[model samples]
Target: MTDSPVLRLDGVAFTYAGGAGVSGLDVSIAPGEAVALIGPNGAGKSTLLKGVLGLVPQTAGHMSFADADAAAAQRPVHAPDGMVGFLPQSAELDADFPINLEQVVMQGRYRSLGLFRWPGRADRAAVRDAIETVGLGALVKRRFGELSGGQRQRGLLARALASEPRLLLLDEPFNGLDQANRDALIDTIRRLKQRGVSVLVSTHDLELARLVCDTVVLVNGTQLASGPVDEVLTLGNVQECFEGVEVEIDEHTLVVPGHEGH
Candidate 1:
């Protein structure tokens, strides 16, 4: 735990034009660690991710990256290319887009390659490795639109991996997956952590968090609790985070009333 953090946010807040957003944020990710962000649909989880990516404006406190050169800055807006990789909700992508699996993954290298360069040997190799890392090596040539939802999700994950990021961010990645797909994704996340990649994921799946994450951050417009998974996910903390919402918990599952279909 003494090693330098890959990313850190200390009392940071990201605000929209109206001055409303998540606040009092404080968290850090070390190499090979995984943290889960659990919350309801509009709890600012997505906003947090966007803020880290510099897609939104930061309105308070500090943000730091591992690079010593930028560590002292108030907010290291936008991590350098390849330092962070993001996999947004699947719905954001156009399923009917004409890209193939390999091509979709190749898109991840674009930021590093910049506007003038084409995919060179190293770029292609990275893309291939990423696709294989997500266990979709056999479907490289398949059309993205033709794959099953799980395969499509894996392809998107591969795209994110192509950048070889030290920190990976996934926003509600397992939302609609069947059991088999969910298992596959959990396996993929474990593999990434074993390879020393840090993961920050926002999800409603308590099972996935228990199985794959080392820590959990519960948010309801703001951070409600954050610590080791077992400690932070206690019944009282969860109930308070989802206040006014129906929540049921048993030995192996935690269910929120409106989240049955998810």
Candidate 2:
């Protein structure tokens, strides 16, 4: 594998029409590394992810993926043909829509296929492989609306993987998942890391971040701290990010007050 970073953002800022977004942000993720974005609500975490995906306009700074330059003036966005795969916080498919698991995954190949071109045999194989990677091969034929919450999340992940992306961006993927499904998802991430896929996950679950990510980036409108997980996720940094929320950090556990039962 090359030693270059999978993603790098220098002084990056993305703004809406009203000008709400994080600024002066800097971070990087190397190949096979997973970095967790941690912050309280309205801390611009989701906005940052949206900026990376080109959903919102990038207002300033530079972003590059795998040595490709994304100047701020160019409004660098992750194109469908780019080497980035994204799984948003909620991929709400219409329950009435009659799409199946395989079909949902196959949609990821459309960009590469271009306009009006159907998925070839190799594309179909890629879809199946992605489904298998997320442990959904047995339910490849199941309707999207029929799956459980966790299963649906995995299906979305499979969709992202179908494009054979080098960098995966996930926003709050473990929210609302049961313990069994959470563990399964964590295992899937671990396997992806082993295979040299870089990951950036935004999460409120500090425990999940510690479990799967190699680094932690704490943000409150802008970056507060970023480094190795153990160093960046200290009580001071987390408390600052959470705005004085009580946090307990043990050797292998993180407990935040007001969220104990959750």
**What is candidate 1's lDDT per residue for 26-78, written digit by digit as tens?**
99889999999988778899999989999878888788777543444463566
Candidate 1: list runs displaced more than 4 Å: 69-76, 246-262
Q: Please, what is the whole-model Cα lDDT of each candidate in the order they appear?
A: 0.85, 0.84
- Number of clashes in model 1? 0
Each prediction's TM-score versus the true structure? 0.90, 0.90
User: Could you tell me the TM-score of candidate 2?
Assistant: 0.90
Q: What is every candidate's alpha-carbon RMSD to the true fold?
A: 4.0, 4.0
Kindly list the per-residue Cα lDDT of model 2 for residues 20-126, writing each as its tens digit.
88887899899999999988878899998888887778777778877666555456556446488999998768856899999999988888899988899989999
Ten contiguous residues with the weakest lDDT in model 1: 253-262
